[model samples]
Target: MLYLTINETNALLRTAHTDAFHLEVSDDHSAVADETEPMRRVLAGLPPFEPDAYPDSWREWDELVGEVTAHGVTMRRVRVVSEPLTDYVRFLQGLTDRNVRLGEDIRWLPRHLVDQADYTTDEWWLIDNARVAFTIFGTDGDFVGAALTEDPAIVDRCTGIRDALWRKATPHADYAPGG
Candidate 1:
């Protein structure tokens, strides 16, 4: 039940030896300062930046994903979104190809496809199937911190949820927003 700063969580994530899974449940994370300008550009109909010219934070994340995957650590993410597609989700969709190129498998699931009671509402990352880091966000969608836990029961439940959703979600290549 220990809470960790974002940096701490990143360090923990970098330690994953086998696999890492991310579950995103929020439609808007506008309060993330780094994404503000990029999201604005997306909303204005500007095309995404070329991969070599990505913003610093994005470049760093891309490098990390590349490095991890090159070492055989599998990285996957599932985003459960409500449609007609929030501008933020659309922005993420625009970035999906680059993410896949960097070696992460990304999927999109329409929220209505699953029973809400089947999973916790919090966003989380399961690292190496051994620990769960739950992201904590403010009411306005600002990420505050993360809570890391190794309690087997919680880990098992999250693992089950991730497996179920991953099977039902559409791969990014096949997902058509608002279709």
Candidate 2:
């Protein structure tokens, strides 16, 4: 496994284009907790992040999606979640609308309905069906790091899984978010 820090991972993604940015989100990693919620900002009557650099995910993500989609790359994401949703998953659902508006096609699949769809214990990103960055998460579903690989067979397998799951997963609009 090739280890890469989160920044290294983002740096690589920034250079990506001409490929589909497909993510298989298998767990709720509480990543959204790190970002300041819009409602909180409204409650505090505060302004948006200034400069909106790396740590400012709201702006960084907006820029990233704008850049990637402008290059004709399709970004699709699928989440496999269990019933009796965790607080993190609920938070994620609240955040999906922003991602959808940013041009990502998001979907959700409940655990009972997973059936035979392929899934990794952790999350992964399939870029262009050519390369993959398998993100490692801790036992508590915290962000760990990622491994980058380009083996054709590995890419092919992940591509097959992504295609299959995406076809069956519920689109963001149709899926109900559990509490």
Candidate 3:
């Protein structure tokens, strides 16, 4: 297992054109609550991030595709986006249109799903391709995301929990939201 802060992960995404990798994301609502707003921009063929240099996700997406096409590793992402439907559709469309498969779990529920004690308040994700997992807060700088590898048993346990959540997750379209 490896540890990476958000910046490290972003860097990996940027330069890792040769390695095939899958990115499984647990939608971090603690930071961005409006999925549609981002999707609206993306569907318009606009960049997903702000107008900053690194804010544009196209380069990262292109690099990720290079990994998949070159290394047989398809980038798979799972997100539970709060929605007004249109943004969810747009976001899903962008992800699905890429070399990535995007899906969602119960985290999109009107109420939060994970226990506060079980996971921190930050956004979390497990990169199955690298077998590395970690979490990042919305407001944290790119360097704030922590890589988990301190304890093998504990990391494996968390991985299992993530898998369980994945198994139980439904497609975003199938979700009832308030249900």
**Which stretches of candidate 3 lie above 4 Å from their native place?**
1-7, 10-56, 81-122, 127-131, 138-145, 172-179
User: Candidate 2 regions off by >4 Å?
Assistant: 24-27, 31-55, 138-144, 177-179
Query: For each candidate, what is the lDDT?
Result: 0.86, 0.70, 0.45
What candidate 1 gets wrong by more than 4 Å, as runs, is 48-54, 138-140
Tell how far residue 117 is off in model 2, in angstroms. Answer: 5.5
lDDT of 2: 0.70
Task: Tell me how far the alpha carbon of residue 83 in candidate 2 is from the true structure, in angstroms, after superposition.
Answer: 1.4
User: Can you give the lDDT of residue 7 in candidate 3?
Assistant: 57
Q: Candidate 1 residues 29-111, lDDT tens each? A: 87787787778777777766544657877777877888788889999999999989988888888778879999999999999
> lDDT score of model 3?
0.45
- Per residue, candidate 2 scores C-alpha lDDT tens digits across 46-165 of 432334532565567688887777778877888888777665566667667878999888998776666554765557888877788988666755565689899998898888888778
Better of 1 and 3 by lDDT: 1
Candidate 1, residue 59: the lDDT equals: 72
Q: Give lDDT: candidate 1, residue 106.
A: 94
Query: Residue by residue across 17-37, what tens digits does model 3's lDDT show?
Result: 333222233333323443445
